[model samples]
Target: MTLAETLQTKLGEWKPAGDGRHSWAETFADSGWAVRIEADRTDTLGCQVWEVALDRVGQADASLTLSAWADRIAASVTGLPEKLKVVEIDQHQSAALLRSDTPGSRGNDVLYFEVRLAGLAKASIRRFKSEHAIGARREQIPFIITHEGLAKVVGDIAG
Candidate 1:
């Protein structure tokens, strides 16, 4: 199943997105946070990348370091792998490319996660077909990343 199809199954109803960049979008709003799951088609048609954006409804502590935010998120989101190694980190964002220690379980199966803080905090998980190193080129396989896991991420960020 494609990301859109899978998201529809998991998230119930989705409204058609008139924006050319996205095919469909669904949002879950709370007191101080809104999480949107979008079927991003900007990359390719073969697959739609699952783009989850977490928007803070109020003032956020922008002083926290990106790494600190990443750590807090990782600690709070129990669904994440036990040992998440930081593959990339900078002032604006921290990222972990979840690859197995073994070589065979690498490549397409690897999951990429990132927490980016600009004016708002955005957390996303995505997979690449050939290699994430290349880009977010869509793959044929369904997403191993779950909606429940994404909700945890949102909750962590909101907290």
Candidate 2:
């Protein structure tokens, strides 16, 4: 199944918000409800970054990021609900990498990239983890590299 299809089947009833700005899919299982939101971007290394945000019944929100690779795509599932563990797997279903420790409230949750060209090596994924103890606490966010997209913006620097 395609990435979108796999997500839709697992999440259910995916509806495009509009203009490819964002889309949402939802499903309910024995555990509770799972909602996945997909946002599109014209930036990066000619690749589309998919952000999968999941929320369970009476639980905190968690998210994962996946992107196309040179040969295959990589996916990392993190921010699991309390007592839950983080899982990472490659396209082959084999264990590529894993991190069980709970991530900070703000920072990169997961990141994947496929660099078919030699220029991507010089590029870097700039990330920041923010926290607001004053009023409302913010959550972690990630920014990935895309080909012919945002990555192109820094191609000269990368080269």
Candidate 3:
């Protein structure tokens, strides 16, 4: 099966978290396994948030590691918008770190940026919004891809 088709099929078996804050999805390919297309909304430090995670399995001797996939994914996502400036890039044994500056958050007050994951066949993306705090209005913004989305993107690249 194609990668996208496999992903769609895997997504169907997901189970929701009891708190209504998270869900898990899974998929299997001829060689690899993908898991946890988690989606959720919540509040953090008075800020609205959302998140998603996608992970891959079976990497005993794969040619493309998660970290390499993350690098390609980062390049793809960052290329989406010029305003999304990459702030930091780091990598560990099996993971990659990406920090970026987003557009203004909360009615042009504070801006939003996130540190997303982009290594490992299984990846995730999380988002964050920060208000300027100087007469700025509070906004119920979506979750920033802090780590979850990065994981998925990396997986996509590797696949």
Candidate 4:
């Protein structure tokens, strides 16, 4: 399934809808939820390259910063509900690279060009509120990026 569809399933009730190039939105209750992923591409020798970094999510989430990543695994799954965990991760060289502690296992890894987010439980959202602030902005819900969508964003032919 595509990223949009995967989000739809994971969210239980939120419907996925696209609003712009690589931008999507969903409606629930009276609020509208959405996210967008944009990557800069450089062409050399007829190949296109893509990248996404933890710094980018840091910029968006406002909880991750140069000083905050001393413990990556803790930070990766921190400040949120217990059930909605950050199961897999993929980071760019620009951002601290996070890999599985268990070796020889490969699946559900995110690449540079995508940010995957998923988690829910109204009470969870309420309890987690007022805890995340990376900059001047505040956030209650985290973005969910899907593994399959990560591949599809940069295209199956390339990373």
Candidate 5:
């Protein structure tokens, strides 16, 4: 099934906000997180490219030890020894950014996952995509993330 179809089945009864197609959002109050997923474009591989962003709500502080959150997100996405590599990181007293190494690509355009911890106690998770304006793109999407995996990652962030 498509990512949207999967999400629709998983996020049952949650009225989607935003454009409702290419871009949309859902709030999971019980989980203390609001998620937005965008699938408006396609990548060079002709695969439908997408991103999922999750933000913590309320008074919770999103601060974390750089190495800890970095490892958590990286481990959550992959298994065993083959894992997401660290590309770059920018750390400050109140904000930080962590980018993982990109996957191989035919062109210079490549997408990577990122994590952001900001001063306002907000954390963001993103999977970047390099879009191609021309050529044929595939309809079968990649990246199958289980809801359990999401909960574990979000739980780590919330704690």
Candidate 6:
């Protein structure tokens, strides 16, 4: 079976958000976080993205929320002896991950770039939009990833 076929099989039960054969996306949301996986373009770009937002961090800095999650994903994905400095001198986790060649890194690491801020406030809420070339006045799609079932497929390839 193809990679997409394997993904579709693994995530057969996941809800869809309207992706076609060329794309796949999935989202997991809770009071504490929102996770989005968009990997349909991975095959061509050799990159897969996993996005997590800080939603209920009572006292955790939002960028730290990204840093913490990125650290977890990096450790899990790389099986490091200890978590490396995800936020490099550039002070950006996404940049570090993109440039890293950690073991088991098939260029499929979750990025933490959207939070390049110096810090995230405890009372502030920040969200980055996923835009797909809107016209002058078209209603923007909700935060949902437009692709439907491709996340599972991409996971098969990336996993």
Ranking by lDDT: 5, 3, 1, 2, 6, 4
**Residue lDDT tens for model 1, 1-159:** 433334335454343445544544434333445556555432212224355566655555768655666556555655443333344455444343322222222545444344444433555543333454556554533233344454454465555
| Worst window of 10 by summed lDDT in candidate 3 | 41-50
Q: How do the residues 1-159 of candidate 5 rate in per-residue lDDT, one tens digit apiece?
A: 433334445543333344423655766666566666554432222212255566666555446455565555565644211235444445656555655555434374444556676643566655554544455332322343444444344455444
Better of 4 and 6 by TM-score: 6
Instruction: Put down candidate 6 lDDT per residue, 1-159, tens digits, no spaces.
Output: 543343344344444344432233332222222233433223321322343222222344434554454454444433211233344423353232322232122143222122222233211111123223333232211122212233322222122
Candidate 5 deviant stretches above 4 angstroms: 1-8, 11-21, 41-49, 59-66, 79-82, 87-89, 107-111, 119-159
| lDDT of all predictions | 0.45, 0.31, 0.46, 0.26, 0.49, 0.30
TM-score of each: 0.51, 0.26, 0.53, 0.23, 0.50, 0.28
Top-TM-score structure, candidate number: 3
Query: Can you write out model 3's per-residue Cα lDDT over 1-159, one digit (the tens) per residue?
Result: 555445444444443445655654555555365655445532221212354455556663557654555455556654222234344445554445554544554564554544354555445555544566565564433543423333334345445
lDDT of 1: 0.45
Better of 4 and 5 by TM-score: 5
lDDT string for model 2 (32-64, tens) is 434344446432222233443334333322332
The residue pairs that clash in candidate 6, if any, are: 7-153, 19-148, 24-150
Residue 96 lDDT in candidate 2: 29
**Which predicted model would earn the best lDDT?**
5
Give the Å error, residue 23, model 6. 7.6
What number of backbone clashes does candidate 1 have, counting pairs of residues 3 or more apart or in separate chains?
A: 0
The positional error of residue 87 in candidate 5, measured at the CA in angstroms, is 4.2
Residue 146 in candidate 6, Cα distance off native in Å: 20
